[model samples]
Target: MSGGIGRRALITGAVAGAGTLLSGCDRLGRDERFQRLLRTGEGGNYAVLRLLQDRTALAQEFRPDQRSPVFRMNGVRMPNGDDYARHLATGFADWRIPVEGLVAHPQAYSMAQLRAMPSRTQITRHDCVEGWSAIGKWTDVPLRLLLDRAGVSPQARFVVFHCADPQSNGTMYYESIDRIDAAHPQTILAWALNDELLPPGNGAPLRLRVERQLGYKQAKYVQRIELVSSLAGINGGKGGYWEDVAGYEWYAGL
Candidate 1:
């Protein structure tokens, strides 16, 4: 079997066992063996995933005929906060995405300005960390163009995305990408999908489409972009929400 298949199978087995254990009892504190087994199993799977991502080339896109009949939304379906609700009421007319951080020039851009920039469209596959995939066409402005316009400084090595979705207590969704992926031709801030205006369920108004990585890395409902030299000072200091909270790999470059 291929490396991906092998790794996926192992992860599946571990998850199954973990689920069984958790179902049997709620006291993870009492089950030291179960806790150790779960952690080790998850770690092994993550390590293998990282290895596969590091060794593999960019994922392949597809022809129009190969696209999915139903490209379901994978992340936040609707943001419930008052701020998001206000924007939605106005049809996002007042929403401005703040672009700041270590750049020579920091600015706020409206959705109109983003839509006005030169754009690229691609029918790429969206691979989820949960082991599912779908193909959908994306239309957006190349991320490099926006970065260039803001004059990203040489010191800026990573771009952090701040979003509107809240995942847990006092926690927000965020992700970061290195300069390499930022400059990729396929990297975009998508505003449309499958030839339709982006839906609220699929990060309407704006979203990041870092085609080279998994779906989680494609942060949705993006409200801000921060350029930084390092990811050390961010929440949990692991570069992303899932990475920090759930031990997902930070550099999911697949």
Candidate 2:
């Protein structure tokens, strides 16, 4: 069977396990949430995978020759807001990603300042909840560097990414991850893709590339990273737009 056929079969099984009786994969094709279960083929995180993953294992990284010819843009393509516009007009020279909330030293980092820091370049496959995948070379500053610089408070348990894009429902797009994923070697604030400055369509200025999670967890247009003790009081209080609105698993480990 072709890779496409096998992947579609996997997707069908993943969705069917959600208790949605499907005559076929057609009508349910549009529902792309809750796909992180594919790690062990169950709708919930498998016990063994979750246990070993606690050791901070790295995701599968690909070689440069394996990079996809084109990486498709998912979710909000361009933010429709005045702030993003102002940043875009200046080529994001004035863009500053603020680190606030439960950190000891709050700081806003500039693009140039970030680029000057020690960076990592990884060629990794981006697994989207949509069941499609793309491999691209991404250059980014390790998220751990920023957290170390800000001195994450002892009470801080989760890192929340605030983005510039607002949904049609009038809420801004944001996502959160635990300190484990935030400290992963592959997890980065990617600013460039395929050796080029990140395109606006692909989250220019900065975006989170938490390699171990599915794509929706990769928040784009990130403007601030707020360290917090809990997710209880944020928008919808579930830690992410999809998690709150669409019932996606908060810890979507791949």
Identify the leading candidate in terms of lDDT: 2
Model 2, TM vs. native: 0.82
Which parts of model 1 have CA positions greater than 4 angstroms off? 1-58
Task: Give RMSD to native, each candidate.
Answer: 9.1, 9.1
Quality of model 2 by C-alpha lDDT: 0.87
Deviation from truth (RMSD, Å), model 2: 9.1
Range of the 10 consecutive residues with the lowest summed lDDT in candidate 1: 50-59
Model 1 C-alpha lDDT per residue in residues 42-151, reported as the tens digit of each score: 66765676566543245577898899999888657988789888888888898898889988889999998899889999899998988898999999998989898899
Reference-based TM-score, model 1? 0.78
Q: Write the per-residue lDDT of candidate 2 for residues 174-226, one digit (tens) a residue.
A: 99998878888999999999999998888988999999889999999899999
